[model samples]
Target chain A: MSTDSAAGLLHDLAEYRARARRDRHGYWLPLLVFGVLILAAPLVYLPPSEWPPPRVQVSADGLFPGQIKVFGLTIEPLYMFGPGNGREIGNPMGVSWYWFGVVVLGLAGTVGWYRWRARRVGVETPTRLVVLAGSVGLLFLLGVVPLILGQALVLLFPGSYFYSNTAFWISVEVFVLAAAGTTVALWVRGGGPRPAWRVALASVGVVVALMSITIVFEAAFGHGHAPLLLLSVALLAVAAIERSAFCAVIAALFTAAALLANLYNMENVFYRFGFHVDYLNPRGEVFANLLLPAAVLIVGGGIAAWSARKASRRE
Target chain B: MSDHPTAGLDDVVHQKHRLAILTIAAEAKRVEFGYLQQNLDLTKGNLSRHITVLAEAGLLDVEKGYDGKRPKTWVRVTSAGRRALAEEIATLRALVARHENLS
Candidate 1:
């Protein structure tokens, strides 16, 4: 080859290398972290005896009766089951399977959607592995923190878990609100269509109104309010349809509200549907703590995967 | 052939450094000045000049605050900046497609 051609080849090689570095560095690292966490979920459930038991004490005078202590805070136990006579009754493995299934399904759906969209667009979209990683990290900070705190509260001060410690719920709500708001702001400012402030304000107003209405209906119908649960489920479904960070926020808010309402009334719609809230009890706190957050993470993860696949197909 | 389809593709933002800065800023909700400098591998002076150009173009908003007593500078892409960056990318892609097809 002539000297000019040789130099030209070298230049092209350099450009390729530069592109590789840029794309690889930004995209792959976070994805690897996410993958590791997903793979580690099953391993998290060791034998129950290896797990610490819920610390519960009945008062001598029956004055502070049936209180459970967790994380240095004292709260009444939500249920009065007989203390463990060494027969491990609860199914941590089943609970893990349910959560894992939700996450996997959600991720698959998201990945599938993205791949389809990318193919249709006929442009290579950026790798969303990094974005997925960031989302997972955000989930840990926002979703996981509140959940752990909520579980701790339930274990420690069972009586006050539902009502008196409004701060915990409020903190969770704030995190969810901020995450949703930041995402909307970023999306809008990132060149997506700008939604009107009035629309947002109206949506908030409507959510509050609906929640209040549900509460009233629940009061009238007692704990078995199918309509209220249906409403909650519908809202969650709508949030998923919206397919933005705001949707995740809305889903989280609705889930939190539903959980609180259930706890307050000592009723579990999730349980009626064969989902367990017994895990929320002191003995099963870790499973309770991990389950819902993991569900939300998986949902978000699925969306990220879908978005990535869409981007790749476009490319 | 032009090295880049985006090469000399003039808009309000065809400048290379400015494009890089905007891209970085757009990805982050907020990014520190030093982080931008390190990522772009630009000198402090070079980064500052490009940042100024972007700020003037209304594509970025630069804020200087104190993290304790030390001064901290952060950059964020404005809505206008995001639009410009998106337009730039689309234009670049189109140019590349056109050139590739012709070749």
Candidate 2:
């Protein structure tokens, strides 16, 4: 075949593939949901007003020491439930609990939305892959990443780690590292030569990033802000799943906002404008984190909706 | 085992319409019959015949199911089909490079 003909064929195939991928995307629904969820997060972080979102009470009545002795089992295998570590971090309502619910709902909502949209639009994205990406990312960021970073903190400043059990944590770190190393080795074995170097580069980069994030945030925001970074990672996973450059940009911006909120006292920005953040009400990092990421998602959803429609018309 | 890339051209997957079908189907987990038929601008019978040919060659898995009361035909590319498609693309890329070099 002639070069022009060959090139033309490739182009045609690529166009079909792009069209297929694009037709399947309903990312705007999830982006909007994510934005609203982020906006609602500060409420969970702050003291409630006259009316509050009803808190689901889990009674510790079932009696436990890392096990539901009544049932002789626990549903949560990764995190065995333990009783009474009732150390409060600012709010009465748990922000971590809020995030946990939101992340689960968000992933679940993604699957439901795609299935619903498929019934309407005739084509649907592979929701299984998207949900899988979100779940894996959720586990990595919420569970694994903090432990790894905690180990780094222990190494960098001895006796400075947040959790006190040094020996247990060391063993946990060793096991986690071995698991991660084996997984990396498996990926790199058949993935050509440079991947080993890339893995090393990535390891160094992650360590440097963890240290920098900790150092930067520790002075301004102080403790419990690490988990706040989890929100942006979910956006990133969806972006990767959809292969949407637009969603990826929004995710990056959200990550920056989350980092900024974590490090800098956002009330200072408000204070410069002669608007003091009322101590009684939600303010400061709460507002800063909420507005930027929500704006990114809510605005991004609008753009995605428009783009999807435009692409549909073009097709 | 000819050295020429043309020798690698897959007879089953080489035609333009079938290649387009594979390309589209390969993008998603599974593709609906109506969507493919509409996208490729093919008659129901024509597309069915093509699907049958690919299914017979073990390149496509055809499932007839109910989406409600309505019957839907779904097509998925098998592992062999993915390998075939990848080989076809590589061969095409090689063919283009060879042509470009001669020019």
Candidate 3:
């Protein structure tokens, strides 16, 4: 090629790079939707019974213990045992809904973080179709199926062993195992340069990890079961906004950390509730809980690092 | 001579605008028409004509679709297109190198 053509090519190349660099648009819409979601979820989730109880009347003398007023609304504190123990227990439903809202907000936060990272890396922002399909599929697989199967198993056994506890364990095992399996699969297959079944599996793995963590954490906190709807929205939002497998990996890491904490705490909580499983022993539980999630994170991170190195080498 | 650096340059692929389109498409994997036009500072008619030329030459693939309500177009470099771009870039680099040597 002539020197002029060579110079022109270099100039065009520079222009292309400059344009891509200037294509930086913030993810404001996703952020707005996330805010609306966080606010709206509690409204939809709170049952009428959970609405703040009819305003309690404080004695005009103000000598009553635990009597407080805020915004002219009299408040009575609930005490397990005290002179002013007239406080009614707040509806558990309300508490559950509140945490559920937090969980959804947490998911939104994760997506926002990933979306910003995606702009830097040039990961394609996921399309609406991808988001819808991924969220719906995860809900069907991890939520609906588990509940139905758990109920059916309870009915079939009619034993205390097979009741709520059995169903809960079964669901956890399925979700965690699926997440680990998918992560390992993706790690082995390597999601690079093209979309493959491994890509789909990686998505499944991330969704299942999120679900498993939500369930385990809710159970640990004695919070109300977070509705699957919140999880579906979280998955949809994250899937829609994030295009990198790294986001999925980050999500998996978050879930794994939660799982480790929950597992350690589960022994004490479940033991107190008169539930004893073999792995409750300090050493055994350590082996049981730490093995899968920890291994998944370690192995997945290693594989991803290696794959990136390999790709860079190829380039 | 057949060994001349310009011998490797493909006429249909080496045009500056098409080279820009190919480079963007190669980097993005799939690039929208509006993106190319905006980036290259070309009018719609001009971009459309250049894209048609590249597509007819089998240097890239043009896909027509809708982005929500608005009509949209995307261009992607095919395997042939990628090879052509790579070869063109290599030749340009060689030409630059030869000129640098002479200077």
| Candidate 2 displacement at residue A231 in angstroms | 3.7
List clashing residue pairs in candidate 3.
none
Error of 3 at A266 (Å): 16
Instruction: Report the number of the highest-DockQ candidate.
Output: 2
lDDT (Cα, tens digit) per residue for candidate 2, span A179-268? 566456445566457565757755765555444443333333333344445556666776776777887898788788777756566678
Candidate 3 lDDT over residue span A241-286, tens digit each: 4434553554345355444444354456556768664531223332
Task: Sort every candidate by lDDT, greatest first.
Answer: 2, 3, 1
Top TM-score prediction, candidate number: 2
TM-score of chain B of each: 0.86, 0.95, 0.92
* Candidate 2 collision pairs: none
Q: What is the lDDT of residue A122 in candidate 2?
A: 57
Could you tell me how far off, in angstroms, the CA of residue B15 lies in candidate 3 after the best superposition? 2.4
lDDT: the better of candidates 2 and 3: 2
Best candidate (score: lDDT): 2
lDDT of 1 by residue, A1-315 (tens): 223433343344344334322222211212222333433443444345556534444476442433445565443321111121122433433333433343444344444543443233211223354236434533532233233433544554457333433544554464456556555544545355656874575466444433333223323322211222332343344334333454457456545644543344332445566666544343333333334433543455465556556754774
Each candidate's lDDT (Cα)? 0.46, 0.67, 0.53
Docking level for model 2: medium
